[model samples]
Target: MLGVSFLPLKELFLKNFILVRDAHIEFSPGFNVLTGETGAGKSMLISALLFLGGADVDWEVFSGQRDEAVVEALFVRKGEVLRVKRTINPEKRRTRAEINGSYATKSALRERIMPLFEIHGQHENELLLDPSTHLSFFDRATGLSELQREVESLFERKVELESELRKRRKDMERLRQIRMLKEYQLEELRRAELREGEVVELEEAIERLSHVEALKEGINRVLDLLYRDDHSAYNKAYVACRILEDLGRFDRTLRPIIESLRGYGAAIEDSWRELVAYEERLEYDPEELENMRARLSFLRELEKKYG
Candidate 1:
């Protein structure tokens, strides 16, 4: 027969566990047997006790209906109470063990509290194999020696959010570098001082000025042909008009021809005057042309360098 100290559990408190969200229960002095139907949380309570005794609990065993699950127990041995608490945190993928309201390790919890109970099941050895067995159940008839062992495997998962946060911090630095590079490029562009339509206007000015000598010669030739030459078109037309006037005095039908010839002479003189005015407007400044060429070359260099 087992003595009173063989069953050392005094009280247990569970919060946010699988089915029992919150529960408080007290055990008798000796040989406490939990009685309930098969699926009535009897096995879950045992698992909770094992978890309190510093045995590793697979994170998947919790229902995940809550963020955290807590299992605490009070054990009595020789008129002394051993209070142990275990907190499971799913988010951080970590487990914490406490003893008597102070933080403790799994080893300390096992060395102190595991000797209080005997656990035996077909798959139960899996949980006990880590440190040692502490809690086991017996039927009402204690003669049956059948044991079922359940081995629970557990692995601490890497918290992906923390990893992602670290990666995001690195990415932030990269983004900052890219932004600074763009700022430097913008500063270069500003220093260059580009104008919107200046390139096209300067190109056109260069095109007109490049052909200045040829245009001047052409305009002088036209002025000579119209007014300065000995047989200029304007003088020839005037002479023709005088002859027509004399001929029209003899023939009345020739009066209209005389009037038309005089009008033609007037139009030629107007064109001659306009040609002289146009010739005076032609200019070729070497310095201005050189400056324009230099400006165009500078713009081309800038395009090759930066664009």
Candidate 2:
């Protein structure tokens, strides 16, 4: 029937609420009463005020389309505006509140805004139903509201401490998980012995080892073609030069030809000797090759495990 405030409650605004899509109610400077017929939303307005004061919400209070229900109130305190707003999200099955446009927890809303307005309804929240809290109502009747607030403040402080304890427990649990992960990572790297540039070096070595047999065979073929038999390039070149020189006695015309190809035969002989020297210097040690193969195999194992 009437709402009271410690400071002036200037206005209340509601939208998409039950039985009324939108409405704005302005309070005057003194005692006031809301006069409306039955089923005219007088009770709805009271329910909205109670909701803003942190009462249990009934989403059935939602109107058409059933999106969201908003209840906002403006209060004057020390020449500053204290705005309290509550929104009901039926889709999410949750309710949220704000004080001065900043998010406020449910307990914070209960502590901060629940006392701004008092309602005497026909609901079960009466002194007869719960006589344990009768002392608070009696204190108000006797103008002991300040003392009642002190008691409530102490209760709120207890609630805050309990909330902080719960948060710290969560933090401790999170730290435990982080420690386990770091230990696991340390063990893996210790086992892997991962090092800088190791992957690149291993890759290059593996490439070489994979093609090593082919490399040896190719070099052997080059040596054989140079001087492995008398029919080889160097041997044949020298034989032609000598036969032409032998024919020079039968005909002097062959003499010029012999002289011309003599230098060519010598060039081939010199090139073949260089090839023999290179073949002698080549390192074709099987033990070293086997060692390289084992290293490549070890590197492959490492790649599979770490990667």
Candidate 3:
């Protein structure tokens, strides 16, 4: 059998005033009794013990006297010294605990105190009448060990399954959001039908059209120099040829001039042919320009829709 022992309360109070001051009690391995007259602090001592166990206490017990109240207990259990301290303020009232004089918490104290001590008050008789609390009371009264083990095992399994269920629910919610975003992105990409290298092709076409005016002006200047009215290169070339032909019989230097005139005449003729071809290419096609404009407009609309 497991053994338990409790040391006496070192100090206790209802408020600033002390109730049980520096009191000590030692219990053996059997029954014990705490008996006193009514209103003689027997019930008060029990209440203090109850407070040490994780029970709530009413603030009215210390109403107008003082704001702070304290109760402290010492225990010697299994060769280890345990200290319990409870403080009550107007705003908060609970137990503070220590093991081997090291600071602990009320929950820690309760864990050690539960098996060592069990308080059965007069109100405990009411459990005999209540069917709900009856079975547990009988189990405790008879020390039914195996049933307690089964209940504890089932309780632990239930907690573990509940924790897993909560985690799965959170994972499912995260996956659902990810799937929705991917589906929307896929739909947008499908509707656009974006083709490879389409952007590069469109950019090249736009660059060519952007320099259209400059290209046309250059071509016109060349054409004018070759074939236009009075200052044309072709007219100048014809005049040079006539002068060289007249001087060719009179001077030897005029033979070189005649040869130069023939070369200039041949170059001008070739330039004239190239100029006609350039003029034909510069002629605008209305249908093709309209198609380019429509395609750019459609691309802009799609970009806006997706964006």
What does candidate 3's lDDT look like per residue over 62-178, in tens digits?
Answer: 555444566666665356456666666644544354455667666655554444444454456432454544555567679874687588779879999999999999999999999
Compute each candidate's TM-score over C-alphas. 0.38, 0.60, 0.44
Give the worst 10-residue stretch by lDDT in candidate 3.
Answer: 1-10
Q: lDDT tens digits, residues 237-307, model 2? A: 67887888788879999877787677776776677677666555555566766776676677677668656
Model 3 CA deviation exceeding 4 Å by range = 1-53, 57-133, 142-145, 200-307
Where in model 1 is the C-alpha error above 4 Å? 1-7, 122-307
> Which run of 10 residues does model 1 get worst, by summed lDDT?
148-157
lDDT of 1 at 190: 86
Ranking by TM-score: 2, 3, 1
Candidate 3 collision pairs: none
lDDT of 1 by residue, 34-128 (tens): 77787998888877877776788686766454578888988776776678889888777688988888899988767556655556665564434
